[model samples]
Target: MTGKSLADYQKEYERIIFFDQPRKDILLEGLQTEMEKQFKLPMRSKEWKKENQKIIAMYRKIVITRTL
Candidate 1:
């Protein structure tokens, strides 16, 4: 193997998962916008909105970690 550390390898893996792959940004943006409209509040200020963001972020983390 090369001289890179394990953490460096892990970072590369995560980068591939989170950044190298194609994502449906437009769909995600539309969904988030619709959710904000439906809630009538910014996601950071509303309890339900905050919860949804947490859930979405968790899912994103899981997907990236697993895919990596």
Candidate 2:
């Protein structure tokens, strides 16, 4: 309502959708549904070693997007 334009709000909307993490509950729900449709991924690999760097990266994106 200040000096902001529609373009400013549009960019903010995109940032919130893309950068901000969703609630954990929503994330879990989406993961469950999407998992069924997903084929084997570089994420859920059978050859994962103890390091698990790839798995951790995927987890960070899904559940650890923001600190609580």
Candidate 3:
């Protein structure tokens, strides 16, 4: 949560998923699967609470820099 809305997460998620393969067919559900694998924890897990801000900032940077 960390003061960021779901929309923010969605926007970042979209950019992260499409950064490498913009033409690929990546569903929203697939993003969730990938994120869980990447973060090594479920979204609902307490670990995400502490890492939320860092994760958001990281993805925002990736989107801004376009350096996947």
Candidate 4:
């Protein structure tokens, strides 16, 4: 976050998150599905609060725009 913009970080985040699916497909064989669910469960809750909400929302917007 020092020299990079949120958009750049968002790109990297997307890359890592996207990379995870194929990695899990090859390595974990769906075993970590529950773990991923557990991890995402609180992301929309009060766990992250307002600060991260802005960032995540921004990332989601970027991803949505890219997909469309």
Candidate 5:
């Protein structure tokens, strides 16, 4: 029941968006790593376009909010 406050979490998230590199870059890199593990691929290829699109779409849907 004890952890970082909502504001602190939101700040961290925003930092990732603003101070960090482009969101797409981060998302694609992580997605590529995961897809590589799941599919045993050595690297992302043109064939993975659809999977990448789906992952990016889902990533955009995530919402972070603050309540206080």
Candidate 6:
């Protein structure tokens, strides 16, 4: 996996938050796909556990911040 930088995520988060409801849903799906592609691990695998946690945490943070 080519580790993505914090800035890359921050930028995507910003873009997602700026989108309207329908677009946001689409973007989130795309983001999830991108994450899966980047991680290159099946969702159920033990190896994916830690990264998945981090990704979910970061996604929540972005959504929370957007609401603020």
Best by lDDT: 6
- Pull out the clashing pairs in model 1: none
TM-scores of the candidates are: 0.32, 0.27, 0.33, 0.30, 0.31, 0.58
Model 5 misplacement above 4 A = 1-21, 43-68
Off-target runs (Cα >4 Å) in candidate 2 are 1-29, 32-49, 66-68
Candidate No. with top TM-score? 6
Residue pairs with backbone atoms closer than 3 Å in model 2 (clashes) = none
State each model's CA lDDT, in order.
0.43, 0.42, 0.51, 0.45, 0.42, 0.63
Please list the residue runs of candidate 3 whose C-alpha ends up more than 4 Å from where it truly belongs after superposition. 1-12, 15-26, 43-48, 54-68
Q: For candidate 3, write residues 1-68 as lDDT tens digits.
A: 23444466568565656544543334444544444556554446565656676664544444454322
Q: Is candidate 3 or 6 superior in lDDT?
A: 6
lDDT of 6 by residue, 10-44 (tens): 67877887788777777766665665567553646
All candidates in order of lDDT, best leading: 6, 3, 4, 1, 5, 2
Candidate 1 structure lDDT: 0.43
The true-versus-predicted C-alpha distance at residue 31 of model 5, in Å, is 0.5
Please give the lDDT score for candidate 2.
0.42
Query: Which stretches in model 6 have alpha-carbon errors above 4 Å?
Result: 1-3, 51-53, 59-68
Residues 1-68, model 5: lDDT tens digits:
44443344334445544433456456445544444454444234656646565543333332222111
Instruction: Write model 1 residue lDDT over 26-56, tens digit each, in one string.
Output: 3334334443354344435556546666444
RMSD of each: 13.9, 12.1, 10.7, 8.7, 11.5, 4.8
Q: Write the per-residue lDDT of candidate 2 for residues 1-68, one digit (tens) a residue.
A: 34433344334334444543445445444553343234223445546523555433444454443344
Model 6, residue 28: what's the lDDT? 66
Error of 6 at 14 (Å): 2.3
